[model samples]
Target chain A: MAGGGDELKLLGTFASPFVMRAKLALSFKGLSFEDVEEDLANKSQLLLESNPAEKKVPVLIHNGKPVCDSRVIVQYIDEAFSGNGAPLLPADPYERAVARFWAAYVDDKVLCHVLEAARGKTEEEKAEGLKQTLVAVETMEAAFKTCSKGKPFFGGDRVGYLDVTLGGLVVWVHAGAALYGMRLFDDAKSPFLAAWVERFGALDAAKAVLPAVERVVEFAKMRQAQAAAPATAGGN
Target chain B: MAGGGDELKLLGTFASPFVMRAKLALSFKGLSFEDVEEDLANKSQLLLESNPAEKKVPVLIHNGKPVCDSRVIVQYIDEAFSGNGAPLLPADPYERAVARFWAAYVDDKVLCHVLEAARGKTEEEKAEGLKQTLVAVETMEAAFKTCSKGKPFFGGDRVGYLDVTLGGLVVWVHAGAALYGMRLFDDAKSPFLAAWVERFGALDAAKAVLPAVERVVEFAKMRQAQAAAPATAGGN
Candidate 1:
């Protein structure tokens, strides 16, 4: 829905949670952007040309300059259109540091463990993966408990940049865990986190832009099967 | 020489580059604090209590509040004492985003490759690790070429937050590469990167606080030996 004069454009793959991150941020700000879906398997010329080094999607092109990396893109969007929506980050230095810390922690710790679990091959490997995932979840739960101050989202009452970044990954995590026949979040164990998940899920912006859960599940299943297929074929 | 009522204390270990990041920032800003060197092998009760979750060193305690993570600690220092030193981050939002991107890239790509190379058990693993390291180096070189704009340091003549964050790891990278028998930064191949390295190393602050190269080399050797010792003893 972006207009012609120096319009905003987002190049992303549908399945990427990273892409969802940018989408949610832009939408929350009520900014219009042209969503150009890139086929990751057969990457478009523009996608490659725009992001030559990484050649990965979720590239935001504004006034001909491209910004790569989801977190970077989110920050860019927040700054470029400062007046569009609520401030993505707090103004106070300590609070801003806390927000950035959690965002980076999500990338470093949570995603690392989740990816390991998603890619586990053997039963033992899968079990170990699940254990690590649980550890990550517990750590996140603790972080939230300490930092939340009774706010519904990471930023308190309303969803902010941290929530957008972390919330986008929930679908992928659930899908990956489902593929491994593991349930990572439950009310009994992580009531607050579970409530948070439900609250995020219920948001209109999230529901509108997020990829269908079924599609994510399918993609995860395909990835796991492909990984297992090669090893199983060798046995045959 | 932090005077009365200046409550800044840094808990860190000698060998950690992450800890050095906070130290360099503090030094650059000319802020004095009580430096607590932690024995990482046996963390102090205060460190354990301060950073209960990660329990890692490089915890910056300002006025009784603890800030964990080296990058976050740097930002905290920058914000808490903004008026004291050269601005750590750029005033422009876009430029700031670019800086944060590079910082995150260093942590994710560069550090990951170095750690992998350090832990590789076989020749194939080592080779793969080296290849990844080269890719990271290449990416950094490209970023520097585009973004540095002939700036001596990352922050145009003065060493800023990005430089300190990345510069802190130079000794470790050089030493770790040597320990793994890999040439990570060849002057002939990475001239710009090599020059930048020299420039960063020449900083008075860096010269003062950076652990001696020989010490880093010895540390890497010790770590590698410890990793291999158990397997060698088992073979015997």
Candidate 2:
């Protein structure tokens, strides 16, 4: 049920890589839109109404028509606002598929592992988390090598599709690793990805979309502390 | 590592909705390709080599390069052969996104629940499975009503993106329901969706891709027997 107009609105929460997908796409397209901050603890009515099935964030509402899921929203922005700034996806189908594939891999294969690793309480759980996280990171390293070649970013000159998708999560990875005193993206192992992260973070869109590293670390610390508190209380 | 020229090949199993997505896309496009059956019990080297990350089937190998994941492969087919028989995705970006969103919902929401419901052993497990499955079904009904808009299909007349996706899964659903003597798609509740299924199943693409209902039911009966036998043996 879309109201006919040119207005763009993004439903999101702060410090979420998923939400950043939609936000970055909008900034990349140079499209001005209302950003509705959602309290995930008590999800907004808009988020529930728009995405009744998933009830998740990063919903891009164009003229009251909602497009949920980050990757879907990014593609929507690229299509809807093609007349604006840099194109979010590559022109070619294969290349577009490659981008889409890697982004999906990042969500499905990588993010879950890293989040589990970050939030794991026990040493055994953390070990399992780290193992899966390494698998994801190494997989991504291979992806960067093949896709980026010797380019600075996945989109070559600019911060393209995979860059936005991974860039959003990289900050979280950094913060989550800090809380655990671990190296999630070891500089030596994934040197290319390390450099690409630096390159992507310097961009205007990333700056506009991503929360400060300190903010993420603080958030991660709070989560870590909360996770530990329950165990400590139980022990007492 | 792409070998030059356009020779299409699909690696899949007989009774997977994931594989059917690729098959249906090819069938809909009127493209001829080699269909290699994968022994998912012991995965083929080709399946592993083609899709190292996920290693799941329904890999569309064009030339020598592989496109893994049903949805991604489907989109690739649409773009690579836009001049072919039936268009899988819509011309407009918004329409394409809507299709993409709902198709993704089918994968992320509906399919898993139904599969779990089909395979559950105990009454409690089945109850949980049915609850989630119904949630998925109700959500799909809402999606069909919104996206379909009184049209014969989600893609208006012809079987479009969402049609291929849900159509691929419908056979398993029918069999799953039959095995338990339950109704997954109650005609009275989802009358529009019920009619839509009948229309979709009658299409040439559905005929080419789908195995007979009897075959699927036999497969389901075998699975149900295997599941029950394990518990029966444990109890003995």
Q: Name the top lDDT candidate.
A: 2
Assess every candidate by TM-score. Answer: 0.89, 0.90
Poorest lDDT segment (10 consecutive residues) of candidate 2 chain A: A227-236
Task: List CA RMSD, all candidates.
Answer: 3.8, 4.3
Q: Score the docking of each candidate (DockQ).
A: 0.59, 0.68
Each model's TM-score for chain A is 0.87, 0.88
Candidate-wise lDDT, in order: 0.78, 0.80
lDDT of 2 by residue, A19-137 (tens): 87778777877777888889877898889998887888888888888888888888888887777777878888888888889988988878877767656777788679779878888
lDDT of 1 by residue, A1-236 (tens): 13336578999977787898999888877777899988776898888888876788899888777888899888888877787768787777777777877887787777766666656667688668668777777878887876678888987888887888887776775665566565566677777887887798789878878887789888777665766686756432
Off by over 4 Å in 2: A1-5, A119-126, A223-236, B1-5, B119-126, B223-236
> What DockQ class does candidate 1 belong to?
medium
Question: Any residue pairs clashing in model 2, and if so which?
Answer: none
